[model samples]
Target: MEHVGVEQFPPDKTGDAMTTALLHLENHYWTESEYLAIGETPERIELFDGSLVVTPTPTVGHQYIVSRLVVSLYEVARSAGLHAFAGLGIRLGPGHIRIPDFLITTELNFDDRVNDSDVVKLICEVISPSNASTDTVQKMRHYADAGIPWYLLIDPRSETFHLFRLDGDRYTEHAKAAPGELLELTEPVVATIDPAELLPPR
Candidate 1:
């Protein structure tokens, strides 16, 4: 696969020519070849702010949490006449981003707006120990920068969850879900979930 030109990965920002010139990254010319060069698959991947980030399958506990959360979100959205999908490819841009967890997309008809399923109204991640820090600080900023409306983090270690809502081009802590508690997020979309329901039983 050829690399994408800066214009190809346009964010909400400008300076397309300058952005392309600044990056020595893969050119849109032969993206197929470059993708093969990566030489790894089956691992979860995401293009964050136009950079590739790989995440492997989670632990059994992580999977359990992700599964339950996905099911619940899907059920809720379906009832509301909205759409919720888990582990469906979402285009986060830079490379194909696959969040092994789940996402809630809004479009009645999915489009590759932000990278597959432009309608993604919400995103959720189960933070295993290996990704605690990055999930906390790194992802917090990245999703916000991407202009994602809602971001949820499921932290098993502490048996906690955090929800951030886009506030003025950035994410502000929308809710913190502790064990046995259900946190609510009702903006850019309206939904509520219980972190404990997604946590692995002790």
Candidate 2:
């Protein structure tokens, strides 16, 4: 993937190249390969149903929760013979690629950059304010459509956790927890995390 000879655009600032690309790419119908060729942009870029979607850079609170989850879940997954990764692009289907905040798989195969759906056991996302709808709605639909067995959403603003188990073409709510509650996940991944521990220190 080439750099396209442009500085990565920050969430608050769009470089001329990015602006030009976004303008031209609108309704252009991009493929997952072309989207991956753009490399790492400051903003989160995803492909869904042949269109490109740019999401805002995650806030500190969002990253904080992701970090905490990694630390908390790694041991549990490892003890149970599973592997975990953060910010890994997953190829869901033709022209569909999603980068979960983190993912848990039965094994660690770092030989490939993008993982196929089969290896993914669980996909987790730390909801940012800028991406609430996309995370809660679009991503939920996409994950279920890809036949992912499990999906977890952690919303920092509300300090809540949501777990969804895939049932046929849709996901049924499996578990949920509010702040200060212990959220125990038994399938896909096994662990109990205190939702409050993921919150940033004031």
Candidate 3:
């Protein structure tokens, strides 16, 4: 993924100084140490080589789905002696990192800046209109390359959910649920998910 420019701000506003600094930082090559040094930020930032992929703050609707999934997955994960996390940074390579909306892992080590990809058992991404391809295409390829066992994609717009299992360097659709249906899974952990419960009360 390439670095799309930073969020723009008006020249006459108080944000001008911060905007100028961010623009200047963009020109420099980013290293893992430098990226880690910046620490937690308001916006979700992923590192790809020397570039940064900045995702804007998620909408309330987007977060609602994530929260619902996390709660549901956490129960299953606990039973299997695993852990579930949301917005956790995962290190794919030396200077490559990606943060899935939600994830299930074998362990939780907060000492590390980001968890290693190998520890991640499953990942979930709730699709947003602005970055649908980033979640569906780019992330799918990268996560599979990293050997993540399972991936779950939830698209609120389409009211659907897709479950995939890594199949030798690629992902093969394992199962899916359409609007108002239940998605059942048996591998990596056994659990059933309802697409309707992911949305806000109507």
What lDDT score belongs to each candidate, Candidate 1 first?
A: 0.63, 0.77, 0.83
**lDDT, candidate 1, 1-202, per-residue tens:** 1223333344436543222221345533424223334433465544544444556577889788877876777667876666766666554445545453777766543433234435667777777787777777776666666667888877787887888777988887778988778888675446677776767777
Candidate 3, 1-202: lDDT as tens digits: 4443444345555433233115334465777766775556687888897888778899899999999888988888999999989999999878999889999999778898698999999899999999999889988999998999999998888888999999899999989997668999886788988888887666
Q: For this target, which candidate reaches the highest TM-score against the unseen true structure?
A: 3
Ranking by lDDT: 3, 2, 1
Q: Give the TM-score of candidate 1.
A: 0.69
> What are the RMSD figures for all models against the true structure?
9.5, 6.2, 5.4
Stronger candidate by lDDT (1 vs 2): 2
**Given candidate 2, what's the lDDT at residue 4?**
23
Error of 1 at 192 (Å): 3.7
What's the TM-score of each model vs. the native?
0.69, 0.82, 0.87
Candidate 2 local lDDT, 1-202, one digit each (tens): 1122222454545533232234332336566656765665676666677676666677888888888889988888888888877888788888777789988887656776577877888999988876688789988998888888999898877878998899999988888998767888887666887888877886
Colliding pairs, model 2 = none
Off by over 4 Å in 1: 1-41, 47-52, 94-100, 108-117, 188-191
